[model samples]
Target: MILISLIFMNVFAITVSLLIIVADKVMSNYGSCKIIINDDKEFEVNGGTSLLRVLFERKYFIPSACGGKGTCGYCKLKVTDGGGPALPTEKLILSPREMSSGMRMACQLKVKNDLKIEIPSEYLEIQEYIGEISVSESVTSDINRIRIRLTDPKTIKYKPGQYVQIKVVTDEGTDFRAYSMASNPNRTDEIELNVKRIPDGIGSTYIHSLKVGDPIEFSGPYGDFYLQKTHRKIVCVAGGVGLAPLKSIVQYWKDNERHRRIELYYGARTIKDLYDHEFFEELARENENFLYIPGLSDPDEKWTGETGFIHQILERKMTEGENSEAYLCGPPIMIDAVMGVLDKGSISDDRIWFDKF
Candidate 1:
């Protein structure tokens, strides 16, 4: 009698599991769908996938640092029609104004039906490229500079200060991380990036482990952080690896606009943390208009150039912020502190652009 009871219970459990499987298949199926981009191009894709993945499969490379997890706000796009209300995860990243403007996180928005989407015209130009690692060397104890030579497309056109998203494949799955280009944009055939090792970070660890001839896939030239065409003086502030984009910007200026006045204030914890110091110092020596200031928040007895945070260094040296364009990149707290200094020095908010990562 006990054996019969156990058999009955097993049958019941199997029946319930089968029912759940059938229900999931029915509910998850959404059939075919269409995506219209800016009323210009259209794509036919299978429904039920997140818009970010679907667009990427179609070669519309969207900047998603969180790998379709809806954590990074980089995948925001305007869905004019057929997109349902914003999801809660999207609300955490997007502002009220963006929500009202019909902006939605591509990673959170599922393509249930036909959708109309709008993105920047520049996004259309962003394409995926395959490259081979040409140079992989350590910049500091934790930072590495990796240079890749484009193999497939062979060349790329991007402004200095823009970034690229590299695809990292691990045992678990694949992920994407954005890195600002450290090399000058004019070097179209090859691109360089500065990656600081983050403890247990998937992207950084993969990058640090790369060999000289390893292959890589990335898409790019994204972001609007490039240098603008103006006669105003340029003020750059960097902390840690945030100097990547600024290095690109300053190199571009040195090669093209030598007459423009540019000042770079770099902050680190110690002298060893200040990598690429000699390059900026050489630029300053070559160009009278370029000034290099390295500051250390915590220094040893031998340190002498500047002591204190980068904001403190800027506050003491920035005499004419008026008619100057400020470019800042660093941690959130550092960017905020430096912006406050730039504000007090007469720099308008409109002229101060920052990228905090």
Candidate 2:
């Protein structure tokens, strides 16, 4: 009698577990979903999943530097119809234009119903890569210059001046942070990123603590802030860690035999803050069309070379009608000031692009 009771109880438990699993799969599958994107392209996708993941699988990628965790706010799409309400996770980031235009957070919205959405055309080229750490070198004081090798989905084919999102975890929770690609597209297997230590920021804190062998997951090849196809001279200005994408662009131009005159302006608080200067100086020598300029904002007593702020040096040198494409990345204050000076030099607003961090 005791043996029979134990046997019956075990069977019941197994049956319950199977039933629960079946129910979960059924609830998660919402059937085939029809996506009408930009009201022009239609996609039929398996349903009951977040729009972010679905779009990527279907080849109409919307940029989400955070890999659909609902943190970075880069993966936004217009949900004209069939979007069922909104999720709490997305409320903090949606702007007024986004909230009113039938737009919804792609990561938050599941394919419960037939949907119509819109995304920028440039984002169509971005591809997610599952990359393994190839190298993690201490390039500067408290800064780690990492190289990742692409494995599954094995290549990040992107234009110069684009960025990828690296995943980060901390004692508190999981989140994602954006970092620009510092390596060129020519070097397909390995991707390079520059991570600076942030005092209390979650993502940087976690990355700073990581060692050489640690594996980190990331996605991208995102952003429209790339070099325009033009014969005009190029001026790239960067401060602190903003040099990542700009460096990629520079390397690309040099590798492709681009003969257009290019000037790079890098700013540092002191000599100690400047990184990889000798390498860039060598690049400048190899490519006669390129010039490297390093400026110090507030140098120590031992400092020399170009003093004062970066923008001041830039303003003193720039002449009108240079017919230049200006790319600036730095703190907000520096970006705004550069914009003002560029405007004064008669440079078109379209010619000026900046990355503010």
Candidate 3:
């Protein structure tokens, strides 16, 4: 009786597997379709694939921080026609105005037929670059500063504060993670990234395990989170490795000798986490316009300087509405706190910029 039951179960499982296979053969066969990008470029791709995957496969990489899970809301494109209805996921991330303007999340929009989508002109210029790992040194116990030298193009032109997406292959599949470039922008042959090892994070683990001379491929110069062209006093706020892009911006300013008064407020849990304070301190010493303020949330008894939250320190130090523009990069909570402080200080929202990771 037991053998008969086991046989019946096996038969049922086999039948279900066969049905799934047949369904896939019929349902997943979308044949060939045309993808018209920005009304200028066109490509033939197989239908029934996510627009994000199709674009990535064709080397037209989109900035997707959540690897096409539709969480980051970074892979948005204007679908003028033939994209079908927007998915619930897309609606969640997109504003009502954005939806009315035909913007949809590329990751959720499956290409069931010929589609017309418009991407940014800058995105069209983004290309994959091959590089070799030149340096991978630990900045802190958990954070590693990786420097890579371009091997193929030998040079990459990018604005300061832009980020690149590093590709990593794992047992599950390929994953891409974005990291801001920390190196001086004047050096076009190489780029630097500061990666904090997150527990059980596939991309960070793979990157941390890489050795010198290891090959790496990444696509980049993405994100609108860069310093605006202004002579106003620049108030830069960073927490932890959020300093990466700010470092690039500051280096660019120093390298070009841009005479802008800049005040940097860096926040960390303790003094040990303030890895690059000395670099900024030296800059402050050399340039009267550049001021470096490092604040510790939790300081030891021997430690001195600023204590408590960094946003509080910023509020105490900065004058309200002094024709200054603010740039912030940090955790969402910290960004919110800082924004509140900036608002109270009469800094308009238009003058405030932030990147929340």
Candidate of highest lDDT: 1
- Could you give candidate 3's per-residue lDDT for residues 1-357 as a string of tens digits? 999999999999999999999998899888999999888999999898899999999989889988888899999999999977778888899999999999999999988899999988889899999999999999988989999999988899988889999999888878898999988889999999999999998889989998999999999889888888887888899989899999998998897746888888999998888888889989889898888899999999977789889899998887646688998999999999999999998889999888888
Candidate 1 clashing pairs, residues 3+ apart or interchain = none
Tens digits of per-residue lDDT for model 1 on 22-53? 99888878899999999999989878899999
Ranking by TM-score: 1, 3, 2
Q: How close is candidate 3 to the true structure, as a TM-score?
A: 0.95
Q: The CA-based lDDT of model 2 is what?
A: 0.80
> What digit string (tens of lDDT, one per residue) describes model 2 on residues 1-357?
999999999999999999999999989888888999777889788888888878766766676665577776777788888886667777788877778777788888888879978777777655656767778778778678888888877776777888876767766665657888889878878888898888897777776776766777776777878887898888888888888888988888887737788888888888888888988989888887887888898888887667777788788776443688899887888888878877877778989877777
Native-to-model Cα distance after best TM-score fit, residue 126 in candidate 3, in Å: 0.6
Computed on alpha carbons, the lDDT of every model, listed in order, comes to 0.92, 0.80, 0.90
Q: Give the TM-score of candidate 1.
A: 0.96
Worst 10 residues of 3 by lDDT: 315-324
Model 2 root mean square deviation, Cα atoms: 7.4
